[model samples]
Target chain A: MNRVKSKYLKGKEKFAIGIDLGGTNIKIALVSKAGAIRNYLKIPTNTQQGKEATITRIKQGIYQIISQSNLETRSISGIGIGAPGPLDFQKGIIHFAPNLPGWEEVPLAEIIKEEFKIAVKVENDANVAAWGEKTFGIAQGVDELVCLTLGTGIGGGLIIGGKIYHGKNNVAGEAGHIVVNKDGPLCNCGNFGCLEAYSSASGIKNRVSRRIKELKISDPSIFYQNNFDQISLVKIFEQAREGNPIVKDIVEEAIEYLGIGITTLVNLLNPEMVVLVGGITNEGDKLLNPVKDIVFHRAMRYHVADLKIVFGKLGEYAGVAGAAALLWDFD
Target chain B: MNRVKSKYLKGKEKFAIGIDLGGTNIKIALVSKAGAIRNYLKIPTNTQQGKEATITRIKQGIYQIISQSNLETRSISGIGIGAPGPLDFQKGIIHFAPNLPGWEEVPLAEIIKEEFKIAVKVENDANVAAWGEKTFGIAQGVDELVCLTLGTGIGGGLIIGGKIYHGKNNVAGEAGHIVVNKDGPLCNCGNFGCLEAYSSASGIKNRVSRRIKELKISDPSIFYQNNFDQISLVKIFEQAREGNPIVKDIVEEAIEYLGIGITTLVNLLNPEMVVLVGGITNEGDKLLNPVKDIVFHRAMRYHVADLKIVFGKLGEYAGVAGAAALLWDFD
Candidate 1:
């Protein structure tokens, strides 16, 4: 199987590489025009070691993925790296990524392209992931779509007419930062009442923790006692499934805020499909049903009639697949 | 001069006829591919006579324009009409136009096309005006743009990748209805604190009137006494220009809210250009400067840098010009 895959990759003329630089790990993959993962490699980001080392490690991971494939370096078309931002995509530099420590305006794309002799495109990780979803996941056939990644901080991407709408300065699709509640909690973006403040994983966790602390509830302190050791969304989903009111309440609030955020996008963009991706979306219809219901009720009737809200299907491979899809466009 | 203009218009095979159906008047024009208005005519809408009479008046206007033009109906590619909504663009019907009394689902386009034996396309006035801006006005050459028409109600249009993004249904660009303040004011759309309630022409007039009534100030009841006299935005601009404290306060507050609304679009669409058209934008730099300052300060910095906000240069002719531009494409 490995030999067949390797042989198939060897014949490609415009292969591309996708590197998903996350906080904890660097995931590199060799992508083909067919949206196939020719080869892939993963390594620790070691963000604590600072920016230089992190870039070096990412470079090495790229090399490892390339070395595993029989493809020639000359035939490689481009390299797409998806990293956490504030980023200057036009300059191919990272501005300041909280996940990647000591990373400050690192011209990672330029360095990689220079060393590897391939074209490089850098985008916000969420944007790239959305590209992946649009190209290979549930958003495959849709032209106008908005993908929301509900993780630590909510990330969004706008895909219009089958291509990414990066806005004026590659900063479009900051849907999470849109104000949902003007008087709600303060968001990390230094704004009051952003959707991210209420709907993201950390947002929900914060809400749950605050409620727990305020009520002085005596239940499983599994999350607090060990610094949320086992209090993940998965466990919370289970609690909600088993009819725990506290867990249900927290989820409900998150979904409510999320609905408002979605409604705002619906009114603004009028996208045909809104794909919800990320770890939290794993709650499936439990989260999606309420969100759809609220958004429909809140949105104008004309805007809601044809709107579709669905969970992403690509799962963990979206980043790499999106990166690979970038190569397909060149072909 | 008429002969010379007729000769120029005759040379074009791809000419479109655009009709801007207004409350009091109907403006008709012949548009060239280069976004030029070859010729135009204005006729009374005569809405008090009812829908059939209004449609007849529109047909007469179309006939007059076509008959006077040297260009043949065969050479005229298509007819595009921009009118008040709610509309069913697909069916080429007007749903409910507040300006046109007893107007509901009037198949204005279909009837016109059948009468003239020409193809007709109909869109909401705001959407067509937005198209005009995108195709020929301040947003010319920009593929992705958003236009805000500050009239009785705030009407907006989104051109995504050069095509109008009409949302899931045909109600995209309802930016006016988007709630900005939860506790602000009651909007006619049954929402509280919508951007329209604070920033539109009527909204501004309403605010000013309410303030006067509340304070029992002895200003002329121009707003209340003469309903049909038309509370001109020019009057307010003049007052603001002269430093009338109350007028200044109202304009500034409206500017602030307008900034908030624009910032929301900047964060959401991130289009290459945002064109502000309508009477309110006539405040020009007074409104533009404050809006730019607030949007830049509040929006994600990356999104702000490349955004260009400019006033519409086409003036009152934009609706007809845009409708004409549609002919450029369809022709």
Candidate 2:
């Protein structure tokens, strides 16, 4: 095997392991400080097998990735895991993640450390993605940045002065639940008019379903036939792009709320850059341009002038990369 | 004079001059690092007298305060001036201040530094007050804090990681202008439903005046009629405290909007503490309790549990203390 040496690698060539634990899959990867993925592996989460079984799968995934690498596991710095929240980062516990069955105050970091005999850190998945973006993606070299992940639920992570700002109780960056329209819609968090209630994929679906019901359109029962399984965001986007008026209106409404949320973040953080990530961001400039335009128009001109809103470059690897970076820094 | 040695005064006690440049008056003081005010002087700010005359009066005010202090001029570290914005902190220029007539892009910091032969820093008055509160008042020992000052207009400052978080253009924290009520009221900034449009003293007066007009009450103007030389916040607070129905309703309405503003800050920064300062806070527990109740009730519960809300304790000396601390740390 040929060993590559470069200035960016430094002397020891530090490396770390990152695990992105999602509802459907568990992805593990070994990453370098330069954001290069050396070896990666993925496995079905099998969350239905319960927490203990799922934890075992996660360990196996890590081992599988490391075994494929030429570098010794000893040289691997530490391990970082990104899981859904609400989590207690200080305690390294997953408080209660709706997506992950039977996850309640799971001591994830300690469990992984005990199994592997290495330092382990855990953070909310969105925060980890933000960290990944800041260190390796669009926000590289920027001091203050905010990353918003638009998926089933809206998630946000704030980086201030190059460090993750986990507010008191590790819930500081819950931008999704921030009320944009106090009288708009009922949110899962029992709040009215939260950005998540309008901006999330599920939020969009709910809005569309409501509008469809009101218009007495032949029940698009196919949309919810498989418990929303057959309904994909891409399908909606495709329809909207093809001039489906109903889909167009729903997407436009979501964009309006997204703009409000973006403006709020701009006014509040005044960050150098705002990086948008997750499944919804795949819509590209179609969604980004309107959101940017409205945010700039609504926010104070002084704060908005230098603001840069861009799509996250790291894609699905963001979590694993960010987790690896965390290990590299702490270990 | 006997100078008692104390732990707080570890080195040769340094002093700094602070200038609060208001529309009506220029208040200058000699301040110690431990939040002590050695001497103070106030002078009329004759803006129509032109920039030169105003600068001359400011210099006189500084000299008068310094002369009254036991400290020598050579021992003074520097000077910190708090002025109205929009300002360029990096260039030390004030773009325009509505309160300060004819103040446009004035290089106040450079002018003062040149005259005194000492380093000078100029910041937005609200930001200075925030630093003042964080360094010596209610937010002492808290690393992440935000201070809100309510007057004719609402002003804000953000203290993140123990340093003021000035955004890309030095306009990071304009919390008052964050739109809470999207369809509520028109703000002077040309925005609809800004927190400043609802919470400021002038905002309260406007809301009360509108109600009186809508009700067609005879002698509606009597409520705001000049009792003596001024219409002060103290007068309004007294009327509300003494059970004036109209004034009480207006104050409650303002407090409701202020609560929303505070909740927005909590949601955004997840600050460890939020301190309320300015003339309006003189309502004490009456005003603070309602705001606290609303913020706690409305914000993410987990994030709000550790959040502390308190009234500023430094009173009028906050600017002087903050300025002194700024210079003392100048090295």
Candidate 3:
């Protein structure tokens, strides 16, 4: 273990249990008010077994952390859960979650609060990640910021006036669903030309597949002729780095569509910074430099004059940290 | 002319002076706290004479209103000006208003405040109109509303949480610049495929010219055989109402682009109401019914489920009414 410094809340040594609940696994962390992760553990959700079973495993994981750290439950201010959403944050109910089946209107907050006898808060996972970036990441103190997660599907959250902006109906930050190209492509939401159709991990993979087929027609002796099914976004990035024309074109097209989407967002919201997360940022300047170049060139001057296009710094810990930040809002 | 009720400040008999400064004329109105206009007047701006001359005209107008209404300056809460923008709202400086010559970085607010010894606020004309709709029109109690003015150019204002959302630099609501078609048409802002390029009054007129030329090739005896220059937006609307296929196609094309642009806004902002302003809306359901149908059909269901698309009720009074509403912000 690394020699960790104490970041407990002063005067009363307070802490929060941050739960990043997902389909495959549940990550529970003991996070101090100062944003230090004192103890952490992960447990398989096994959600297929049932919601109650997964809840039991989560509770056990929480108790395990408390016992290992020799801390009293009284010292923990609250438990914050950042879960997949389409949720009712006001009522602390999970209306529906695609990843976790049978999560229809489950009062997750109430269940946890009843079991642990501690205050609990539930929020959208993407929103928590945005708040996490603001609280303990590179975007600290940025009152107006946009955060995007580029994974299987693109999810986004807006931070306005230093808080998550849930629209009139709690569905405000659906940036992925905003149409970029009116006739470009169809999205899962049955909309034509959504930003997600060209920018998500799946979107990128589909591009790779289509580009390879087009290349094979032009040149019969192209690379990855037989192992096309194994061609991943990582392999595409590696191939682009190694100077493959087909992969380069694919990456450029995706980034161009992403740039157009971001330009629309800049025109509309005029956010101070746009923070990116997920595995795509591992490409570093390869992704950020081109996106910045295109977005700046396309967006209006005043809106982009002081804009910062950066990556989220907290890594995997962002979700848990943001969840814990919910306690601050509760206070 | 009409018997008006007092909407003055509850504790004090106070009113506000609202000036709608335009390229050709300046419309000034004395308005009570409840958004009732007690006195109004319009004067030629003669902007070509210079910024100082225009300032003098505006000052004289203010004095004339005070004298005509038999109201003392002390009873006026503030002077609010709604002018063409790219402005510095914080310092009340007009950065570069193209409509008004030699008006770069002119400190209008400071000069007005010094002369009147009263508070003064300067805002984008479109923003003021939106505020006016909220204060005195159909959207009086609607907090989240989007107001659009479709004239020679399209201007938009967003009321988020019941306040004007000034982006990081107070230039947030440039909705006209939002790209609807990435490769469609050129905008004055040097961008390709802007909403303004396809939906503005000039845009509509240009569509008529292009469509007329295209129709001449297919059919010679079209409506405007020789007098194309006299083909105004009103004429196009009138012709379309008469069931002219060429004119109808032109109007439908413009409305289609407008609908696409508005659909993007609905998906992004999820506002409760959208208020339409300007002459195009004078066509009533001819313009609105089709737009509403297209927009609702294209936009996400949740965003438009309970949405109300209506025309601004205050009509010409919106500018001055919105300007007066600026005083409420100061309070």
Quote each prediction's TM-score: 0.83, 0.89, 0.89
Query: Candidate 2 clashing pairs?
Result: none
lDDT (Cα, tens digit) per residue for candidate 3, span B239-258: 77788877786677778777
Per-residue C-alpha lDDT of model 3 across residues A1-331, encoded as one tens digit per residue: 1123233423566688899998878999998778888899988889899888888898898888776655667667888999885787777898778788887889999998988888899998888889889988988889998898776677788887777877676667777776777786677667777787778777777777776676565542343435644546777777777878777766776777778778888887889999998777888898888889878987888889899999999998988899988988532
lDDT of each: 0.78, 0.80, 0.81
lDDT of 1 by residue, B131-200 (tens): 8887777777787788888988888888876788775567778888766765567887665677888899
Arranged by lDDT with the best first, the candidates are 3, 2, 1
Name model 2 segments beyond 4 Å from true.
A1-13, A88-91, A210-218, A222-250, A329-331, B1-12, B209-218, B227-252
TM-score of chain A of 2: 0.92
- Between candidates 2 and 3, the one scoring higher on lDDT is 3
TM-score for chain A, prediction 3: 0.88
Per-residue CA lDDT of model 2 for A29-74, tens digit only, reads 9898778998888889988999989999998887777666655556
Computed on C-alpha atoms, the DockQ of candidate 2 is: 0.51
Q: What is the TM-score of chain B alone in each candidate?
A: 0.91, 0.90, 0.90
